[model samples]
Structures are given as structure tokens and as C-alpha cells.
Target: MSINQIQDEIIDEFSLFSDWMEKYEYIIDLGKHLPLIDEQYKDEEHLIKGCQSRVWLHAGLEGDKVVFTADSDAVITKGIIALLVRVLSNQPAEEVAQSELYFIDKIGLKEHLSPTRSNGLVSMVKQMKLYGLALHAKS
Candidate 1:
């Protein structure tokens, strides 16, 4: 589906909930929908260092867009990574580079995360954006 469609869906899901717990449960459900990453991709190169949980993200350019596959050993962390991928992945390199993570604030994610987890989430976003910028430069 298109990014707008994904955003609409997320908005719809969250809008239905009046409680933070329900909203988080929906986000976790969305994460469960993400396909599992390949075991081989869990190596050091793919690993996102400095995160409390083992989060791995692999990105590639498909035509003009950046595609990503990610996983985390912890369930809630995996959900967080899935949410990040949803907001950032599958866009043209230039678009990915320019995109602000509007959803992060809209979803109140930072308040929900511990300081370290929040920092790790920022690290993940920076890495993804860097990969997109590098691809834009190469192209």
C-alpha cells in the first residue's frame, strides 16, 4: 500500500482508542504484521549497536526507493522498529532524507520509551536516513 494509505490506517487505528494502553496494543499488533527478518541478517553488520535490545536493520535501494527489513529480539522493541520502518521506508532516497518523523510525536512514542530506548530509536532513524542519503548521492 502507499505511504499515505499506511498513515491513514495508523491514524484510524489510533483514533479508535481513548487509552494509551489500547493505542500501544494496536501498535504492537501492527508490528506483529511485519514479516520476520532472515536469520542470516542478524549478524554484526546488520546489528544496530548501542541499543539495549538487539535490533537489526538492513536497507537497500529498489529502483529509486529505499526498502528495509528489520527485527529486534525484544517484542516491544520490535514493534518500535516496525513503527520506524513504516514511517521511513519505501520512499525515494531524496524523500526519505527530507521526511520528518511526524508520526513519532503524533504517537507520543518518546514519552513511552525509556531514555536509552528513545536514544536508540533516534539512532535507528539516523542510520536509515544516512543510508538513504548515501544512495541519493550514489545515484
Candidate 2:
């Protein structure tokens, strides 16, 4: 699916919950299902800098698409990244780099998160786009 389509799906999913507590639980559940990142990429180089928790993100090009893999020490952070990856991963590099991730606001994720977590989320998006830019150059 395109990034916007995926974001809309997520928005739809989040809208099903009646309250923020249920949304939090759903986010945690999403974290449980996030694909594990390779142990080799868990080094300092892949670790996201601004996150309060340890988050490692790695991106690679598969043909013209950028594929992302990530892990986070915190469950909620892990789920947040999982949401991002679901929207951005396996997409064309330029598209990933330029995509507008409106789902964060549409789903009210930013308002719901702690300030530090929100910063971490922004950092994660920046890193992903950086990877996209670099990978696009290579391709």
C-alpha cells in the first residue's frame, strides 16, 4: 500500500478504541508483534540518539525500495516505531524520504505521549528519512 493508505488504515484502527487507555494497550500489543531486528545491527551506529529508551533502526535497499528493521528497549517506543515502519518500509526510497507522516497527529499519538517519547518519535522519523535519502542516492 502507499504511505497515505497505510496511515489511513492506522487511523481507522485507532479510531475503534473509545479511550486513550485502550489505545495505549493497543500500541503495546502492536509492539509485541514487531519484527525483531538483527542482533548485528543493534550497535551504537544504529541506535537512535534522541530517544529516552534505546532504539536501534536499520534501513537497507531492496531493489528500489527501502526496508526498515528496528528494536526498542521500551514497549511503547517499540510499537511507535513499528507503526512507522509499517507505513514507510518496503517503499521506494524517494517516496519514503518525502512522505508526510500525518498519522501521528491524526491518531493523536503525539499529544498522548510523554514529551521525551514525542521527541524520540521525531528522531526516529528523521533517521528513517535520512536512510531513505542515502539509499536513494545509492540506487
Candidate 3:
């Protein structure tokens, strides 16, 4: 699916929960299911710099699309990355780079996070877009 379609699906899913606690649980569950990143990519080069927790993200081009894989030391952070990966991974490089990730605000995810976590989230998006831009240039 396209990025916006995926974001809409996530918004729908988050809307099912009645409260923030349930939303938190759901986010944790999403984290649990995030596909494991390759051990080789867990090095300092892949680690996201702005996150309070350790998060490693790697992206590669497959055809014209960028495939993202990631891992984080913190559960909430992991889930947050998983949500981003679901929306941005396996998409065309330019599209991924330019996409507007409105789901962050649409689901109130940004407002709900701690200040540090919020910064981490922005950093995550930035890194992902950087990857897209780099890979797009290569192709």
C-alpha cells in the first residue's frame, strides 16, 4: 500500500482504543512484532544520534524502492520505529523522502510522548528521509 493508505490504516487502528493506556499497549504490541534488523547493521554507523534510547536504522534500495529495517533498546521507541517502518519501508525513494507523516499528529502520538521521545521521533523521521534521499541519488 501507499504511505497515506498505511497511515490511514494505523489511524483507524489507534482509534479503536478508548484510552491512552490502551494505545500504549497497542504500540508496545506493534514493537513486539517489528521485524528484526540484521545484526551487521547494529553498529555505531546505523545508530540514530538524537534518540535518548539506542535505535539502529538501516535502509537499502531494492529496485526503485527503499527498504528500512530497524531496532531499538526501548520498547516504546521500538514501536514508534515499527510504525514508521510500516509506513515508509518498501516505497519509492523519492516518495519516501517527500512523504508527509501526518499520522504522528493525527493519532496524537507526538503529543503523548515524553519530550525526549518526541525529539527521537523527529530524528527517526529525519534519518529515514535522509536514507531515501541518499538512495534516490544513487539510483
Candidate 4:
């Protein structure tokens, strides 16, 4: 599926929850399902700064697409990265870089997060796009 299609599926999934508590539970569930990054990739360079908890994201180019692997010390934060990776990974570099990610607002994710976590989300998106850009240039 395309990036937007995957994002739309997520939006549909999050829309089922009626309240923040339920939504958080769903997010934590998603985190639980996130395929973990390798131990080697979980080191210093992949660690995302500005997060209250440790979040490590590693990206690699496969053929013409970019694939991402990530993990986090926090459950909710792990879910947040999982959502991003679901939409962004295994996609063309240009698509990943230019992704609109409208689902963040549609699912009320940004508004529900604390100020610090919100900043971390922004940083995560920035880093993902930067990875996309780097891979795009190489291609």
C-alpha cells in the first residue's frame, strides 16, 4: 500500500476508540507489536534527543526504498514511533520525505501528548524526513 493508504488505515484504527484512555491503550498495543530494532542499531547514533525517554531509530536504504527500525524505553513513545514507521518505512525516499502525515491530527495524537512528548514527536518526524532526504540524494 502507499504511505497515505497506510496512514488512512491507522486513522481508521484510532478512530474506533472513544476516549483518550482507550486510545492510549490502543497505542501501547501497537507498541507491543512494533518489530524491535537490532541491538547494534540501538546505540548512541540512533538515539533520538529531545525525548523524555530514550527512542532509537535506524534507517537504511534497500534498493530505491528506505526501511526504518526503531525502539523506545517508553511504551507510548514506542507506539508513536511505530505509527511513524508504519507509514514511512519501505517506501520511496521522495514519498517518505514529502509525507503529509495528516493522521497525527486526525487521530488526536498531538493534542493528547504532553508538551515534551510532542516535541519529541516533531523531532522524530524531522529525523525520518532527513533520512529520506539522505537516501533520496544517494538514489
Alpha-carbon deviation at 64 in model 1, angstroms: 0.6
Candidate 4 deviant stretches above 4 angstroms: 112-119
Model 2's C-alpha root-mean-square deviation from the true structure amounts to: 1.9
- Candidate 3 residue 45 Cα shift, in angstroms, is 0.9
What TM-score, over all chains together, does every model reach?
0.83, 0.91, 0.91, 0.90
**lDDT (Cα, tens digit) per residue for candidate 2, span 41-117:** 99998887654677788898899999999988888888888899999999999999899988989898875344555
Q: What would you estimate as the lDDT of candidate 3?
A: 0.84
Clash statistics: count for each candidate: 0, 0, 0, 0
Off by over 4 Å in 2: 112-119
State the lDDT of candidate 1 residue by residue for 74-136, as single tens digits. Answer: 666778788777866888888777666655566666653445554355667778888889989
Clashes of 4: 0
Worst 10 residues of 1 by lDDT: 111-120
- Order the numbered candidates by TM-score, best leading: 2, 3, 4, 1
Tens-digit per-residue lDDT, 1-139, candidate 4:
9999999999998888889999999889988886769999988888876546777889999999999998888888888888888899999999999988888888998653445554366677888999999899999
Lowest-lDDT window of 10 residues in candidate 2? 111-120
lDDT of 4: 0.84
Please identify model 1 stretches exceeding 4 Å from their true place.
1-9, 112-115
